[model samples]
Target: MPPRQQAQPFAKDERVLCFHHEMLYEAKILDIQPSEGSEGGYQYKVHYKGWKNTWDDWVPADRIRKFTEQNKELAAQLHAQIKHLQKSSAKVPKKGGRATGTDSARVSEERSSGAVAGSRGPRRARDYDLEQEDGFHARPSIKLPVPDHIKGILVDDWENITKNNQLVPLPHPHPVDQIINDYLEEERQNREPNSAHFDILEETMAGLKEYFEKALSRILLYRFERPQYHEIRKLWDQAGDDGPNKTACDTYGAEHLARLLVSLPELVAQTTMDQQSVARLREELVKFTTWLGKNAKNYFVSEYETPSQKYIDHARSF
Candidate 1:
């Protein structure tokens, strides 16, 4: 028999409040996707309690909180208290703001009465969730730990990309550009002048530069420019001999490189004029991947899941 699916935190038909588009709406769990990584790693598809199909979508487990009547009452009571406080304060004269002894006693009595009146029913999941949400809402809008200069970069260069009202961090163009340039110069000198080999080498070098640079820019913009890449700052940080854990940006860079290396033949088939050029480009791709794998195992490519089968095949081929 097939192995049993891992258990999920929330089950189907459970009432929840989902955070979507920065707003919380009542919803119900329709399905659960078990974690492929660790516990508490489930994703859920939910239908908003009163909305149409358009508003229905999958949300992360953390983004969906249990909706309870007790919590609802607590929220209502909190709002009512705030309203009461506002009204009581407004009654004080602007010229002489000190509260009279009678006024103070009356306000205290009202507060005590309100608390006693609303203190009913057992505590629910909503109570705990609301407490957490209060802290979450109190924090500054931007969640990423990026600096002002980084924010400047986002505003000036990456005006289009942002998440949670904050700028996503950019990935560093490490060793990739340097490796390609250094190889190009070394190969250029080593090639025989006025020969077909030299011509192929030059053409392949140009093709590889255009391919990698364009691919890197697009990949960085599309993948790294998101709040999900918050750990991306670690990629820019200088580490000791035993470097820090690989960041999301690092994995992305490695994946792109690996995919590019594996897909070289297909890419070369389009732009390359001769088999000689294709062969030369593939050789360079191999060198790049080899250097990446040796020098940066954690970042470039790990035994972890890769982007495609071709990447696996190519890495094994080398």
Candidate 2:
């Protein structure tokens, strides 16, 4: 029930008797948490009337909202709708050899109901994981290897690219690195004046594939690696004492905005340090920093520049 009259602001520690959870619940801001691990949003601690501790619960600022009696009615209506949908969907025979509908719901039902067998696997063939998973974090699929006949001509193609640039990096001792180096070196040795231009093109493609695969992986892992909420809360709590990197952790992303006007300086410092601590920062930067310039005139830079697998997968495949 909305208050009969006005209850004025319930200042801290002030209280009155409330018979029901519904009567006096409105979203009131607690405090903005700056150092919590999250991205874009006001990181708030809120008090909502709907919580287990409705009178005094701290929730993410985005999560706080008013509760209504109609919520149960809405849920019941949705359940009824789902049941009707399932009944209509069940009419199609489970014994049908193929399919009757295009919806994923139907497709899922067919699979569960044994309408389709396991024999029909994925249709569009994919190569392996593009990020080498084990260590190199390479692509997960097989690169279409140039056949031995084309391999010879492709070697010349690589050397031709080499002349335009400088010497390629010598392969490191790792078996994977060595294999890649061997392929490139062999191509250089056997380059005919008339090496098949297409073969060279493929070799150049191989170089591109390596760069893109690593660069994309590094970007993905860094961006989604963690959120700012809990991390910030912990650091904020700790900084009240003393913790290393406290200044850096509280600075970047959502941390920048939420903590409070007074605490903004510390949060800013944390953000800068957080960005600097990005894993393998320099190595990741080097991988594809020059890629745009190298392939400025070409199409499909994303595809061609990504190391298709380089020597790592070829070694694995062989």
Candidate 3:
């Protein structure tokens, strides 16, 4: 009989489950394999219960036990029906008996077909060849015909090769160059090119391209040297908090520099302000700008117009 499936633990072979009743259990089949000789299918002892420790019966996979809308009484009736089925099969005529000749002939034909199928014999399976397999996404496959062919040969002069220890990251050399030259060959073979690897490739190419662009730009920038100087100073001043050390040499540069110098004292005074002074400044600044800027403005506003996102992330974490 097949094993039953329930909300119970299921193991291999012991397919029966008992939830509907103690005597009547579920027989959800675990397997439908042939038994020891050529008699029929095999039912393994997956779980144990009822009549003995366990009972083995060779049954088909379609014969799984279930308990949908079933209870103790229905379960017992199902079990009785299965037991009757087993006994009724024994009353059939012997396989070679005159009355069972038709059944006997069918069994012989099946056995004869199976014997020819076996006599065809087994052949050796081919080994998994790396070259035969397609590379992922049509990428060039790593060609490593010989491991010992590559051992030691330098390529790029700027490249750093590790000696049993590599704390710094190094760039991947052209695969053929490494493989043919016998340098970083093992690592070259292991390196796989994916989306991230392609991104890194693009970034590296961009950096190399930028080197040439800047070299050309400096040659063409000779005409606007003074104006470019002023622009650069402005950017420097903005970066340096418009301080005394920052230089200015263009129109309205003096006036802007004066305003910056005047504001310097207020910025310095902020560090010394008591709570009362801070409150007063916060109020005055709010009235002047129509906004106090931020809660941390009084102490450090003119330098930083707003608190950094780092502070927001830290506050959010808390």
Candidate 4:
């Protein structure tokens, strides 16, 4: 005879704390379903509080706990631990004005090991591409140094779209792909043609292009930008070129790309890469983001354009 089904502990719309990596986030249970696994438990669809809808996902019972004062205290403790780890990792010593690959790798390894050992549950290997996946997970505990001016740009970008009802003009003068290529060209001029640094730079830029294209429609845009996204999709469809070749990278500019950079920590946390690989990727990302900040004036538009009344009406109709 089959094993009896286990009773469900959570109900739909219930508020709870769900574990993602070593941290606990407040979440609301959206739906519940019986587990199909040999173990006869249930799964819950959770919407993480304050996160985008794209981050909502189904999690097993083991990853969730009741939302009580105790759990809240636990969550705060975990958050503090995470912050401490990030601070520790960020202190890698510099060699010749740049972090030595060895030191960075060692720091990342220590951090990763500590997180795993201290986590509340076993880390599951996800069967999805890190580049394309979404939802909360263990983020590689590293921080990117975005400049103060660039932070101001992010604030303005948010205000323009969600508050002012403005839109970034399409076919931006400096598209994401162009900005990446320009950075690559600048790097190549200083490095040997066939050197390891140049090769990694090329591969990293290529990955960034692909990642920007995939992540834009998935997690990069806010709800206010959905109408613009659909419009872009319609144009691409009408042109009879819909596929990998037609992508946001060729149309969106540095503003959107900056959004992607800011979101990278969450995205990178979902990957199954080893500490060293994660560290290396972090280094490359830091270099590119720093370059992007320097060229912000040239790449980012001075002002966002206000959408036409007709366009706004059409968007609202959707």
- In lDDT terms, which candidate is top? 4
Kindly report which residue stretches of model 2 are placed more than 4 angstroms away from their true locations once superposed: 1-33, 36-42, 54-100, 104-318
Itemize residue pairs with steric clashes in candidate 1.
Answer: none
Cα lDDT of model 3 by residue, 162-251, tens digit? 122111111111111221123223223322444232343334334323322232222211121223334555665676854433322111
TM-scores for the candidates: 0.27, 0.16, 0.15, 0.56
Task: Give the winner by lDDT: 1 or 2.
Answer: 1
Q: Say which prediction, candidate 3 or candidate 4, comes out ahead on TM-score.
A: 4
Candidate 1 segments whose C-alpha is farther than 4 A from its true place: 1-175, 193-195, 217-255, 269-276, 291-318
- What's the lDDT of the predicted structure labeled candidate 2? 0.28
- On residues 8-62, what C-alpha lDDT tens digit does candidate 2 reach at each position? 2233322222111111233455555342343323344444324433344433322
**Where does the lowest 10-residue lDDT sum fall in candidate 1?**
114-123
Error of 4 at 169 (Å): 0.4
By TM-score rank, best first, the candidates go: 4, 1, 2, 3
State the lDDT of candidate 1 residue by residue for 1-318, as single tens digits. Answer: 434554465789998776543234567998887655443356799887656666567776645555765334323433343344345545747785664432233234334434210111123433333433343333322111122332333233322321222222224344344455555676567545754446766666566556665544323332313223434445435553355434432334433444344334334444524433332343344434444444453343222221344533432332
Could you tell me the C-alpha RMSD of candidate 1 in Å?
Answer: 27.0
Candidate number with the higher TM-score (1 or 2):
1
lDDT of 2 at 85: 39
The number of clashing residue pairs in each candidate reads: 0, 39, 10, 1
Residues 108-187, candidate 4, lDDT per residue (tens digit)? 43344342102233222512222222222334543455666888888778778767888888877889988998998886
